[model samples]
Target: MACSVATHNTKSNPPVTTTGSDSDSGINGNTNNTNRLNELKFDVFESITNFAGNFDLDPDQNFYKNCTNLSNYFLCDQFACKFKTVDTQKSFSSIHFNARSLVKNLDAIMEFIETLHFQFDIIGISETWCNENSPPLNIPNYTLLSKNRNGRVGGGVALYVSNLRSYTQRNDISLTNISCDSIFIEINQNHGKNIIVGVAYKPPDVNSNHFVDDFDKILTTIDKENKLNYIMGDFNLDLLRYTSINSTQDFLNILYSNFYLPLINRPTRITSNTATLIDNIITNSHDLPVTSGILYCDISDHLPIFQITSFINDSFQNDVPIQSYRLINPLNIENFKQDLATNGWDDAQMS
Candidate 1:
């Protein structure tokens, strides 16, 4: 199904690659970067009931350190592995931008990310130029989970989910309820609770009331399951001019009544004649612990919006009191045994 694909991390699996050229790998003078990325391979596994992912760095010292730095976006050890300690809350960064056209700006976006001096796990993009016909974009260490406009052009949404955590798209939630594009997914936090992430793009001409009603349905459906919701994207609504009885009041009312906190208070899109706060990030749960603002990057007309949220450890660490296991079925048992037996056992022990 086009809805989803899952794979277990196994030695037999081949490396995954994108179709087009690797001309803009963000790393300079590294023509071999794509091959190196392919070498740092892993996979995701899912059963009928649950989903999980695991990957180990290759032991080559230089390759391992280079891949780790590139994969984690140059984050310090404290930021990337914050979950290693129990009872310690670590902040996770998420970014959102109205790309105007994603294809043309992909390289700039990657370059911009590399300069951030820290790591962020999720990015929501609106007006991605990709339709059903566009080829896949191969961003190393990140997965592009997207929803293209089915019938029209110019409007679409995507989530650039980092490979650092486990995530599954919510195919059950339909985006056709409203006249826009969106991608919804459930992020498995490794604990019993999952975080619901919704990235949406609402056309400027769509009626605010209808949009509010449809959006309410989406939230109510997710809320019924008692999941925390973080919705971010470009709605094209001028929230700065909001009032108790304005044209966009119903949408604001729904958000306010649902306890959804709007994180960006400044203008996101600025033209020569106008400045509007159309892009935003909102959430209903305080337990997620988020702080946010607008970034002054010049990648697009819409300034990038960002949020930092605290999450417990959600990686492949087995000692976190979560159940995780892997079954080994070596293809060549005799060779494996002989290889193990041939090691310098006495010398290693004496050392």
Candidate 2:
């Protein structure tokens, strides 16, 4: 069976609720308010320094003054004033799911993505079960890059990259000598280093040793490119069994030796009796800050996993002015007063 994937965005707004004065509304209203507040707690906090409104009273009096309840007030205040500093770092976000068959769940996947508060940069799918004869799969505002299995019926990998990003398919890397189903693309970032994104799927029936050797060759090729890279997909090897399974241990060892780190530590597939983490997103950029986890979606047997990585531009970091402050000691205060009294006032008067 194939797995399906979906995307997630950072949510900032609180859920809206209606209020009533009926006696019966007390318990339900309170419960709804508590649930909404809990939802707001997970919202991604963003900088409000550049917001084009008065930081003093405009937000409080004009924007949040009419907030219906405590949840609304906290959500508005959190977005409007919680963060004071601007975040200049750029980020790349990607989501991967094993869609056992994409065509059947395309609508559900689209609906799920639309519900996310933020959009992902790349959407990867494993086990697409698509071939040359299959109908074209498309997503709005994204370009699809897929590698379908030739003779097989159930294994394939695909990537849907946002049209806003400039990318080129890496045929040379993807057209390997092995039977691994994969697709590779290079994202060209204007302000930061380019990122190589690849998606692959290894069938459960495939020989572990052969699959690992083939996958390693691909990893080695990308590693030699020496760019920030993320390889995501369903490897069909349970990472939870790393310590117990020899093949799983070898798979992880190869990744670590290649300087790649798997971001997902939890299980991606769960049933009544067993849980397994066969789906993953592994990256080589260890220095960058990254957040990754499995999303609780039930469109398929496999849960969707995602990664959001903040890439710091060295040039931008170098350009940012460092704030240096004078010590507020008595000597500095007296010197400041003496300078203020003695300095020429021509420039100040002209201004």
For TM-score, the strongest prediction is 2
Each model's total of backbone clashes: 1, 8
What residue pairs clash in candidate 1, if any at all? 7-44
Q: Against the true structure, what is each candidate's TM-score?
A: 0.62, 0.65
- Model 1 poorest ten-residue lDDT run: 43-52
List model 1 lDDT by residue over 36-121, tens digit each: 32233211011101111121211122111211111111122223243233232245567887887888888888877666545567
Instruction: Give the per-residue lDDT digits (tens) of candidate 2, residues 1-351.
Output: 222222223344434322212122111113333343233221111111112122232232222221121112112122223222324237788888788899887778877777654568899999898888788789998998888888768888899999888898898887353456888899987765689999988887788988887878888888777578998899888765565678877787677567566777655665533455678888876555666755556678777777777666453334432232323558656766776798899998999
Question: How many clashing residue pairs are found in candidate 1?
Answer: 1
In lDDT terms, which candidate is top? 2
TM-score of 2: 0.65
**Residue 243 local lDDT, model 2:** 50
Task: Return the lDDT, model 1, position 191.
Answer: 54
lDDT of 2: 0.65
Model 1 residue 266 lDDT score? 51
Question: Model 1, residue 2: what's the lDDT?
Answer: 25
